[model samples]
Target: MAEKAPKEMSFLDHLEELRWLLVRSTIAILVLASLSFFISDFIFEKILFGPKDPNFITYRFFCSISQSFGLEDVEICDAKMPFIIQNTSMGGQVSFLIWTCITAGFIIGFPYILWEVWKFISPALYAKEKKYAGAFVIVSSLLFFLGVLFGYFIITPLSVYFFGSFNASPEIVNEFNLESYTSMIKTSTIACGLLFELPIIIYFLTKMGLVSASFLRKYRKYALVIVLIVAAIITPPDVISQIIVTIPIMALYEISILISAVVGKKELMESTSK
Candidate 1:
């Protein structure tokens, strides 16, 4: 009997498909970003700069908790931050606007971007795998946005409080540049968002047989240490701040282990059936 030729797609066909995906994703990002630009003032004032104020919701919540515990020395009880933000560059405002729009675009377009990525990889997966598209997108996007919120509401504030209040001498004052402050917020938010996709990454790796539950379990302790180190890097030096940041990440790691085990079982079942 004659051997059947392997199915193949032309290079140009692949390129055309990829081009449309990019075009659609870019359009979605721009539309969302344009909407975000209209609310940029609110985003900056109410959300971005909220951590800098003592009366902010997070600060108020922490203050109430402290009062309930009878802790009189809580840092959240401070009247105001002692720092001033300034812009020194000539085109700093314009540059800031452009980058801020792009950042907003990425955040809003994250789901669509994931969809495009899924489409690219879906051709290589089995029918059973394709069924997970919606769950993967929804769960991954939720985790990412949750991470961004945690970074903004918790990690950023703690770091700002620690670094802003730190001084070598009583006479020294802290004056931060607007660009620098915004950069810190943006980096922290996006970094955490990406970090929270660990379980999804592990799921795919497990599906591909590149990783297993045993491997993850064996290295679990090391992962915990790394998570704590990362938390320390992103948060204030205080143990409370580090613990708060590490908890969710530890939870995510445990979830990743469960996901890997599920994937491993599914692969085993499929193989046995074949």
Candidate 2:
């Protein structure tokens, strides 16, 4: 049996389709957001403010690792951080609450969002491509959550530690604004989450003939430099922190290259058989 081409939908038809996708996605986000709002206290105190505390799980885990290696004076093992978070604006708290809910909505609703996106694109894909739909969603979701965890547990703590301890002079105090602190945490978490979609991105790009494994390999060094630059931008200026952040990103890039190769080979074999 011959496969049929996707129907040519009008501009308005496409718009209507997109509108429904958005509507469904929005509903999902709102439902999740409403639930999260009810538990906002726990989210704010335990998850959002976690990195700022000396007893945060990441800090304790690293502290234990350091102790095992006889590096007992590791900075993360400290009893307390020498900084404070405060709100300078009158509406800062209110704004923070609203934005936090929106962010939580997006994160919690990400799987549904992916489903909608896949639905919109699936009609254009080959039968073989459609077969991998479940795998695509599972792998992408896992990578995003892992990236979020990395950002929350690793990047956030390192940033807090560096910024909190930094003092140009004894007269200066490190009283960070609440808005700024939340913004840092949000950016780190969300940015890493998106960045971790590299493999999925490469897979699609390979399918579209927009990227290839050889090209990625050829530019590997340049990609490493770009990854390091990104790490430096998102993390503290310290070499150790930058290296820690860059390592996972570099690993993701290698994985992306492998995915691209697999996708490219599969597509090529299918075309040849046809």
Candidate 3:
């Protein structure tokens, strides 16, 4: 039996395909987020607000590290976050829950979302590249999750402790809104997750001839300034916390440089052979 000809996809056809991909990704996120409704108590009391407590694991670890270095009275160990999380609006609590669940859903469903995105882009790749679909999803997901953990465990804790406790004066007390608190967590986690995709982004940009390793190297100093600025922005105004956040990001940038170099090498080899 003869097979029918494959229909050539137009611009609108591609847009339609993207729309379906987004729908599937959204469903995946919502479904996973919905499951958190069963564990709302744990999510709010323990996981979401874990960084606010002095006894959180990140605090304890930093305390031990500080003590080991002979630094007296580590802030993380002794400091109590002197702030109250209150709801200002009538639906503030309800809205917070919804947003929290949605954020959690996106983070949890990240891998599935990556799968959908890869499906959309896979047709553009060569057969050899297509074989890397599994690796791409796994590595990208792992990096994202790692970034999320880093933000939650390190950056969030430090920021929470610093801002929650810091008083400009003895008169001004910190009364944090519920929405504001969740925004900090959501922004840090999501931002870090996206930032950690630097290497992957660089690899593809190199492949597409949009960027090269030389370009990255040329602007390494500028990237350093930008990284430091980002670290300072997301983290507390302390040198230590900023340094901790900056290290991983700088490492990712370096790794991106290496990835770009390898991709360029591969493309050059392929071209030379032809």
* lDDT: the better of candidates 2 and 3: 3
Maximum-lDDT candidate: 3
- Model 1 C-alpha lDDT per residue in residues 1-274, reported as the tens digit of each score: 2222244568887788799899988888888878888988987888778778867666676666666767767666673678877899999988887778878998988988999988877777666667889988899899899989877887788667767777889998999988999999899888889989999999889978899999989999998999888777755444565676789888998999999999899779868876
Model 1: worst 10 consecutive residues (lDDT sum): 1-10
TM-score for each predicted model, relative to the true structure: 0.87, 0.89, 0.92
Clashes of each: 0, 0, 0
- Encode model 3's per-residue lDDT on 1-274: one tens digit a residue: 2222345578998899999999999998889889977788898999888988878998787777667778666566686888999899999988888878888899999999999999888767776677889999999999999999988897788778878987999999899988899998889889889988989999999999999999999999998899788778755544666787788888998999999999999899888877
Model 3, CA-based lDDT: 0.85
Candidate 3's C-alpha runs over 4 A off are: 1-8, 230-240
In terms of TM-score, the best-performing candidate is 3
Candidate 2: what lDDT?
A: 0.83
Poorly placed runs, candidate 1 (over 4 Å): 1-7, 10-16, 66-70, 233-238
Candidate 2 clashes between residue pairs 3 or more apart in a chain or in different chains: none
Which digits, one per residue and each the tens of the lDDT, describe model 2 over residues 140-247?
899999989888888888777777877899999889999999999999898889989989888888989999999999999998998788777655454555777788
